[model samples]
Target: MELLLGQSETQVEYDRAGTIIKGQEVILPKRKHEDVHVNNHTSVWGLWWKDHQWAYKCCQQTIRNTYCTGSAGIEAAEAALDFIMKTY
Candidate 1:
Protein backbone atom coordinates (compact mmCIF):
# COMPACT_ATOMS: atom_id res chain seq x y z
CA MET A 1 0.00 0.00 0.00
CA GLU A 2 1.13 3.54 -0.76
CA LEU A 3 1.66 5.72 2.26
CA LEU A 4 0.44 9.31 2.02
CA LEU A 5 2.96 12.01 2.86
CA GLY A 6 0.61 14.95 2.37
CA GLN A 7 2.76 16.37 -0.39
CA SER A 8 1.48 19.18 -2.58
CA GLU A 9 1.15 16.92 -5.61
CA THR A 10 -0.77 14.32 -3.67
CA GLN A 11 -4.53 13.90 -4.27
CA VAL A 12 -5.23 14.82 -0.65
CA GLU A 13 -7.36 17.80 0.32
CA TYR A 14 -6.63 19.95 3.34
CA ASP A 15 -8.70 22.47 5.24
CA ARG A 16 -7.64 25.99 6.25
CA ALA A 17 -6.19 24.55 9.45
CA GLY A 18 -4.01 22.11 7.51
CA THR A 19 -6.01 19.04 8.42
CA ILE A 20 -6.60 16.09 6.14
CA ILE A 21 -9.92 16.73 4.39
CA LYS A 22 -9.84 13.61 2.25
CA GLY A 23 -7.26 11.26 0.84
CA GLN A 24 -6.11 7.69 0.78
CA GLU A 25 -6.59 5.61 3.85
CA VAL A 26 -3.47 4.51 5.73
CA ILE A 27 -3.20 0.93 6.93
CA LEU A 28 -0.15 -0.11 8.96
CA PRO A 29 0.36 -3.82 9.02
CA LYS A 30 1.46 -5.80 12.04
CA ARG A 31 4.99 -7.18 11.92
CA LYS A 32 6.06 -10.67 12.83
CA HIS A 33 8.62 -10.97 15.63
CA GLU A 34 11.30 -12.40 13.35
CA ASP A 35 10.68 -9.63 10.80
CA VAL A 36 11.58 -6.66 13.01
CA HIS A 37 15.03 -5.25 13.72
CA VAL A 38 16.74 -1.91 14.17
CA ASN A 39 20.30 -1.53 12.89
CA ASN A 40 20.89 -5.23 13.54
CA HIS A 41 19.43 -4.92 17.00
CA THR A 42 16.03 -6.38 17.78
CA SER A 43 13.44 -3.76 18.63
CA VAL A 44 9.70 -3.35 18.82
CA TRP A 45 8.01 0.00 19.15
CA GLY A 46 4.91 2.00 18.33
CA LEU A 47 3.94 5.66 18.07
CA TRP A 48 0.66 7.52 17.88
CA TRP A 49 -0.81 11.00 18.25
CA LYS A 50 -4.07 11.76 20.01
CA ASP A 51 -5.58 14.93 21.46
CA HIS A 52 -2.41 16.85 20.62
CA GLN A 53 -0.35 14.36 22.58
CA TRP A 54 2.14 11.74 21.50
CA ALA A 55 2.10 8.17 22.81
CA TYR A 56 4.80 5.59 22.39
CA LYS A 57 4.74 1.86 23.02
CA CYS A 58 7.78 -0.37 23.11
CA CYS A 59 8.89 -3.77 24.30
CA GLN A 60 12.22 -4.74 25.75
CA GLN A 61 14.58 -6.89 23.73
CA THR A 62 16.11 -9.81 25.62
CA ILE A 63 19.34 -9.82 23.66
CA ARG A 64 21.93 -7.20 22.86
CA ASN A 65 19.61 -4.56 21.47
CA THR A 66 18.32 -1.03 21.79
CA TYR A 67 15.05 0.81 21.45
CA CYS A 68 15.24 4.23 19.84
CA THR A 69 12.63 6.82 19.02
CA GLY A 70 13.95 8.15 15.73
CA SER A 71 10.53 8.87 14.27
CA ALA A 72 8.14 11.76 14.77
CA GLY A 73 4.56 10.65 14.28
CA ILE A 74 2.54 7.51 13.67
CA GLU A 75 3.04 7.49 9.91
CA ALA A 76 6.78 8.03 10.07
CA ALA A 77 7.14 5.57 12.88
CA GLU A 78 5.11 2.92 11.07
CA ALA A 79 6.99 3.54 7.85
CA ALA A 80 10.33 3.21 9.57
CA LEU A 81 9.18 0.08 11.33
CA ASP A 82 7.92 -1.41 8.09
CA PHE A 83 11.17 -0.62 6.30
CA ILE A 84 13.25 -2.24 9.00
CA MET A 85 10.99 -5.27 9.06
CA LYS A 86 11.33 -5.71 5.30
CA THR A 87 15.01 -4.86 5.03
CA TYR A 88 16.41 -6.85 7.91
Candidate 2:
Protein backbone atom coordinates (compact mmCIF):
# COMPACT_ATOMS: atom_id res chain seq x y z
CA MET A 1 0.00 0.00 0.00
CA GLU A 2 2.83 2.39 0.82
CA LEU A 3 4.36 1.69 -2.56
CA LEU A 4 1.10 2.32 -4.40
CA LEU A 5 0.10 5.42 -2.48
CA GLY A 6 3.68 6.50 -1.84
CA GLN A 7 5.15 6.55 1.63
CA SER A 8 5.85 10.27 1.56
CA GLU A 9 2.95 12.44 2.80
CA THR A 10 2.20 16.14 3.18
CA GLN A 11 1.05 17.19 6.67
CA VAL A 12 0.65 20.79 7.82
CA GLU A 13 -0.77 22.92 10.65
CA TYR A 14 -1.68 26.58 11.12
CA ASP A 15 -3.43 28.93 13.50
CA ARG A 16 -6.73 30.79 13.25
CA ALA A 17 -4.97 34.06 12.46
CA GLY A 18 -3.41 32.41 9.38
CA THR A 19 -0.11 32.41 11.21
CA ILE A 20 2.13 29.37 11.32
CA ILE A 21 1.40 27.35 14.42
CA LYS A 22 3.48 24.46 13.15
CA GLY A 23 4.73 23.03 9.90
CA GLN A 24 7.06 20.15 8.87
CA GLU A 25 8.58 20.65 12.29
CA VAL A 26 5.56 18.67 13.55
CA ILE A 27 6.51 15.62 15.59
CA LEU A 28 4.17 12.74 16.30
CA PRO A 29 4.25 10.38 19.24
CA LYS A 30 5.46 6.94 18.25
CA ARG A 31 3.54 5.37 21.12
CA LYS A 32 0.46 6.10 23.22
CA HIS A 33 2.59 7.25 26.11
CA GLU A 34 4.12 10.00 24.02
CA ASP A 35 0.77 11.08 22.65
CA VAL A 36 0.01 13.56 25.45
CA HIS A 37 3.35 15.31 25.33
CA VAL A 38 3.54 15.49 21.56
CA ASN A 39 -0.01 16.69 21.08
CA ASN A 40 0.40 19.51 23.59
CA HIS A 41 3.51 20.65 21.78
CA THR A 42 2.10 20.33 18.27
CA SER A 43 -0.11 22.74 16.33
CA VAL A 44 -2.35 20.13 14.67
CA TRP A 45 -2.69 18.56 18.09
CA GLY A 46 -6.32 19.36 18.84
CA LEU A 47 -7.86 21.34 16.01
CA TRP A 48 -10.93 21.11 13.80
CA TRP A 49 -9.06 21.22 10.49
CA LYS A 50 -8.55 17.59 9.50
CA ASP A 51 -8.23 17.21 5.74
CA HIS A 52 -6.33 19.00 2.97
CA GLN A 53 -7.30 20.09 -0.58
CA TRP A 54 -10.67 20.84 0.99
CA ALA A 55 -12.30 23.18 3.43
CA TYR A 56 -12.60 22.26 7.05
CA LYS A 57 -16.15 21.40 8.07
CA CYS A 58 -17.52 23.09 11.13
CA CYS A 59 -20.31 21.55 13.18
CA GLN A 60 -22.64 23.11 10.64
CA GLN A 61 -22.49 21.38 7.28
CA THR A 62 -24.37 24.05 5.33
CA ILE A 63 -21.33 26.28 5.42
CA ARG A 64 -18.73 23.81 4.26
CA ASN A 65 -16.10 25.90 2.42
CA THR A 66 -13.55 24.97 -0.21
CA TYR A 67 -9.74 25.39 -0.38
CA CYS A 68 -6.82 24.78 -2.68
CA THR A 69 -3.30 23.55 -2.07
CA GLY A 70 -0.63 26.26 -2.05
CA SER A 71 2.78 26.26 -3.72
CA ALA A 72 4.66 25.86 -0.43
CA GLY A 73 3.14 23.17 1.79
CA ILE A 74 3.12 25.08 5.08
CA GLU A 75 2.56 28.52 3.62
CA ALA A 76 -0.33 27.25 1.54
CA ALA A 77 -2.02 25.58 4.49
CA GLU A 78 -1.75 28.76 6.56
CA ALA A 79 -3.24 30.87 3.80
CA ALA A 80 -6.13 28.47 3.30
CA LEU A 81 -6.87 28.34 7.02
CA ASP A 82 -6.70 32.10 7.25
CA PHE A 83 -9.13 32.54 4.39
CA ILE A 84 -11.52 30.09 5.94
CA MET A 85 -11.46 31.91 9.24
CA LYS A 86 -12.07 35.26 7.55
CA THR A 87 -14.77 34.09 5.15
CA TYR A 88 -16.50 31.72 7.45
Candidate 3:
Protein backbone atom coordinates (compact mmCIF):
# COMPACT_ATOMS: atom_id res chain seq x y z
CA MET A 1 0.00 0.00 0.00
CA GLU A 2 0.95 3.67 -0.40
CA LEU A 3 0.79 6.33 2.27
CA LEU A 4 1.08 10.03 1.63
CA LEU A 5 2.12 12.55 4.23
CA GLY A 6 -0.32 15.41 4.85
CA GLN A 7 0.33 18.14 2.30
CA SER A 8 4.04 17.42 2.40
CA GLU A 9 4.14 15.65 -0.93
CA THR A 10 6.04 12.79 0.65
CA GLN A 11 4.91 9.29 -0.24
CA VAL A 12 5.73 6.02 1.42
CA GLU A 13 5.18 2.56 0.05
CA TYR A 14 4.67 -0.40 2.31
CA ASP A 15 4.49 -4.08 1.77
CA ARG A 16 1.94 -6.48 3.27
CA ALA A 17 4.04 -6.67 6.43
CA GLY A 18 3.77 -2.88 6.97
CA THR A 19 7.43 -2.34 6.26
CA ILE A 20 8.32 0.73 4.31
CA ILE A 21 9.47 -0.34 0.87
CA LYS A 22 9.99 3.12 -0.51
CA GLY A 23 9.96 6.71 0.69
CA GLN A 24 9.37 9.95 -1.15
CA GLU A 25 11.98 11.60 -3.31
CA VAL A 26 14.30 13.84 -1.36
CA ILE A 27 15.03 17.34 -2.50
CA LEU A 28 17.58 19.85 -1.30
CA PRO A 29 15.01 22.14 0.27
CA LYS A 30 13.28 19.35 2.10
CA ARG A 31 16.57 17.80 3.18
CA LYS A 32 17.70 21.12 4.61
CA HIS A 33 14.42 21.54 6.41
CA GLU A 34 14.84 18.08 7.91
CA ASP A 35 18.39 18.92 8.96
CA VAL A 36 19.86 16.18 6.83
CA HIS A 37 22.95 17.85 5.57
CA VAL A 38 25.15 15.51 3.60
CA ASN A 39 27.76 16.59 1.16
CA ASN A 40 29.70 14.13 -0.95
CA HIS A 41 28.67 11.36 1.35
CA THR A 42 25.96 8.72 1.59
CA SER A 43 23.63 8.53 4.55
CA VAL A 44 22.06 5.37 5.80
CA TRP A 45 18.96 5.51 7.98
CA GLY A 46 16.75 2.72 9.19
CA LEU A 47 13.57 2.11 11.19
CA TRP A 48 12.82 -0.86 13.41
CA TRP A 49 9.99 -2.21 15.46
CA LYS A 50 9.35 -5.46 17.29
CA ASP A 51 10.77 -7.91 14.80
CA HIS A 52 10.59 -5.47 11.91
CA GLN A 53 12.89 -2.88 10.40
CA TRP A 54 13.60 -0.94 7.22
CA ALA A 55 16.53 1.16 6.17
CA TYR A 56 17.33 3.59 3.42
CA LYS A 57 20.76 4.41 2.05
CA CYS A 58 20.48 7.79 0.41
CA CYS A 59 22.67 10.18 -1.47
CA GLN A 60 22.27 13.56 -3.14
CA GLN A 61 21.17 11.95 -6.40
CA THR A 62 18.95 9.21 -5.09
CA ILE A 63 16.67 9.25 -2.09
CA ARG A 64 13.98 6.83 -3.08
CA ASN A 65 16.54 4.11 -3.45
CA THR A 66 16.56 2.12 -0.21
CA TYR A 67 17.79 -1.09 1.30
CA CYS A 68 15.41 -3.00 3.59
CA THR A 69 16.20 -5.35 6.44
CA GLY A 70 14.24 -7.08 9.21
CA SER A 71 14.83 -7.90 12.87
CA ALA A 72 13.50 -10.60 15.15
CA GLY A 73 12.49 -10.80 18.80
CA ILE A 74 13.02 -7.11 19.30
CA GLU A 75 10.69 -4.54 20.88
CA ALA A 76 11.51 -0.91 20.11
CA ALA A 77 8.52 -0.48 17.81
CA GLU A 78 7.77 3.04 18.88
CA ALA A 79 11.11 4.30 17.69
CA ALA A 80 10.52 2.89 14.25
CA LEU A 81 7.06 4.43 14.11
CA ASP A 82 8.36 7.82 15.15
CA PHE A 83 11.20 7.70 12.66
CA ILE A 84 8.81 6.91 9.86
CA MET A 85 6.42 9.66 10.89
CA LYS A 86 8.96 12.39 11.35
CA THR A 87 11.30 11.53 8.52
CA TYR A 88 8.59 11.67 5.94
Candidate 4:
Protein backbone atom coordinates (compact mmCIF):
# COMPACT_ATOMS: atom_id res chain seq x y z
CA MET A 1 0.00 0.00 0.00
CA GLU A 2 2.71 2.46 0.93
CA LEU A 3 4.63 1.61 -2.22
CA LEU A 4 1.53 2.17 -4.29
CA LEU A 5 1.03 5.44 -2.44
CA GLY A 6 4.60 6.50 -3.21
CA GLN A 7 5.53 6.32 0.49
CA SER A 8 9.17 5.76 -0.36
CA GLU A 9 10.71 2.34 -0.81
CA THR A 10 9.40 1.16 2.52
CA GLN A 11 10.68 -2.20 3.57
CA VAL A 12 7.84 -4.62 3.97
CA GLU A 13 9.13 -6.66 6.85
CA TYR A 14 7.87 -10.21 7.10
CA ASP A 15 5.64 -10.24 10.17
CA ARG A 16 2.08 -10.66 11.25
CA ALA A 17 -0.11 -8.78 13.75
CA GLY A 18 0.82 -10.78 16.82
CA THR A 19 3.79 -8.90 18.11
CA ILE A 20 2.15 -6.95 20.90
CA ILE A 21 1.43 -8.60 24.21
CA LYS A 22 2.41 -8.50 27.87
CA GLY A 23 5.63 -10.16 29.05
CA GLN A 24 6.88 -10.02 25.48
CA GLU A 25 8.98 -7.61 23.46
CA VAL A 26 9.23 -7.56 19.68
CA ILE A 27 11.80 -5.51 17.83
CA LEU A 28 11.59 -4.34 14.23
CA PRO A 29 8.91 -6.82 13.29
CA LYS A 30 11.22 -9.81 13.55
CA ARG A 31 10.04 -11.00 16.97
CA LYS A 32 13.59 -10.82 18.28
CA HIS A 33 12.16 -12.44 21.38
CA GLU A 34 8.38 -11.99 21.57
CA ASP A 35 5.71 -9.19 21.93
CA VAL A 36 2.66 -6.62 20.68
CA HIS A 37 -1.59 -5.59 17.38
CA VAL A 38 -4.43 -6.15 14.83
CA ASN A 39 -4.53 -5.76 11.09
CA ASN A 40 -1.46 -3.66 11.67
CA HIS A 41 -0.19 -4.68 8.26
CA THR A 42 2.87 -2.60 9.01
CA SER A 43 6.46 -3.66 8.59
CA VAL A 44 8.03 -2.20 11.70
CA TRP A 45 5.45 -2.02 14.43
CA GLY A 46 5.01 -3.05 18.09
CA LEU A 47 2.92 -1.90 21.01
CA TRP A 48 2.72 -2.22 24.80
CA TRP A 49 0.25 -1.01 27.38
CA LYS A 50 1.50 0.80 30.45
CA ASP A 51 0.37 3.51 32.82
CA HIS A 52 -2.94 3.96 31.13
CA GLN A 53 -1.08 4.65 27.90
CA TRP A 54 0.23 2.72 24.94
CA ALA A 55 3.86 2.40 23.99
CA TYR A 56 4.22 2.45 20.24
CA LYS A 57 7.36 1.23 18.60
CA CYS A 58 8.37 1.43 14.95
CA CYS A 59 11.49 1.27 12.85
CA GLN A 60 13.55 0.33 15.86
CA GLN A 61 12.19 3.32 17.70
CA THR A 62 9.65 3.73 20.50
CA ILE A 63 7.47 6.68 21.47
CA ARG A 64 4.67 7.01 23.95
CA ASN A 65 4.23 10.76 23.74
CA THR A 66 3.02 9.21 26.62
CA TYR A 67 0.31 8.31 24.13
CA CYS A 68 -2.56 6.71 25.93
CA THR A 69 -5.36 4.43 24.80
CA GLY A 70 -8.32 2.78 26.43
CA SER A 71 -7.24 -0.44 24.80
CA ALA A 72 -3.86 -1.87 24.05
CA GLY A 73 -2.38 -3.80 21.14
CA ILE A 74 -4.15 -2.79 17.96
CA GLU A 75 -5.18 0.61 19.27
CA ALA A 76 -1.61 1.17 20.30
CA ALA A 77 -0.46 0.31 16.79
CA GLU A 78 -2.95 2.70 15.36
CA ALA A 79 -1.76 5.48 17.63
CA ALA A 80 1.86 4.74 16.91
CA LEU A 81 1.26 4.67 13.19
CA ASP A 82 -0.43 8.01 13.40
CA PHE A 83 2.55 9.56 15.15
CA ILE A 84 5.34 7.76 13.34
CA MET A 85 3.84 8.34 9.89
CA LYS A 86 3.32 12.01 10.60
CA THR A 87 6.49 12.87 12.49
CA TYR A 88 9.03 10.79 10.62
C-alpha RMSD of each candidate structure in angstroms: 19.1, 22.0, 22.3, 20.8
Better of 1 and 3 by TM-score: 1
lDDT values of the candidates? 0.52, 0.43, 0.44, 0.47
Can you rank all candidates by lDDT, best first?
Answer: 1, 4, 3, 2
The residue ranges of model 3 lying beyond 4 angstroms of the native Cα positions read: 1-6, 24-88
Worst 10 residues of 1 by lDDT: 55-64
Q: Per-residue lDDT of 1-88 in model 4, one digit per residue for the tens?
A: 7677876653444347755444434556565533433234233234545566444443222452333333455576678879999998
Which digits, one per residue and each the tens of the lDDT, describe model 3 over residues 4-84? Answer: 443576679989998877895444653443355234223444422223444333321222333322232122444666889
lDDT of 2 by residue, 1-88 (tens): 7697875566667788877666667478676742432211222223334434322222211122222222344565577789999998
Displacement of the residue 21 alpha carbon in candidate 1, Å: 1.9
Deviation from native of the Cα of residue 12 in model 3, angstroms: 0.5
Clashes of 3: 0
Model 1: per-residue Cα lDDT over 8-47, one tens digit each? 5658888899888789667788977646766433234334
Which of 2 and 3 is the better model by lDDT?
3
Flag the better candidate by lDDT, 1 or 2.
1
What are the runs in model 4 whose C-alpha is more than 4 Å off? 1-71
- In terms of lDDT, model 4 sits at 0.47
On lDDT, the candidate that comes out on top is 1
